[model samples]
Target: MGADEKAQNKAEKLGGKVQEGLGKATGDREMEAEGQKDQSKANLKDAGENIKDAFKK
Candidate 1:
């Protein structure tokens, strides 16, 4: 994966973590779940990009 994609994925994961933390502090189950979902999506995208790169090599 390119640098931009990697950075974006990292940022997304970080944002999700922050969101989850805030949700937990506020006792919002829905927000916490959404944050977890966001993190998972970002991780999946990163994994997919890595797979593509491997095939290219």
Candidate 2:
């Protein structure tokens, strides 16, 4: 994966974590679920990137 993608993924993951924390603090179930979803999507993207890079190699 490129540096930009890596950075984006990292940022997204961190944002998700922050969102989750905020949700928990504010007692918002919807926000917590959205945060989890975002984290899962980011993780999937990272996994896809790794697969693509492996194929390239």
Q: Taking the candidates one at a time, how many backbone clashes does each contain?
A: 0, 0
TM, every model: 0.97, 0.96
Tens-digit lDDT track of model 2 for 1-57: 999999999999999989988999999989998888889989999999999999999
Error of 2 at 17 (Å): 0.4
- What does candidate 1's lDDT look like per residue over 1-57, in tens digits? 999999999999999998999899999999998889899999999999999999999
lDDT agreement with native, every candidate: 0.95, 0.94
Give the winner by lDDT: 1
Q: Return the TM-score for candidate 1, rounded to 2 decimals.
A: 0.97
Compute the lDDT of residue 6 as modeled in candidate 2: 95
Off by over 4 Å in 2: none
State the displacement of the C-alpha of residue 16, model 1, in Å, after optimal TM-score superposition: 0.4
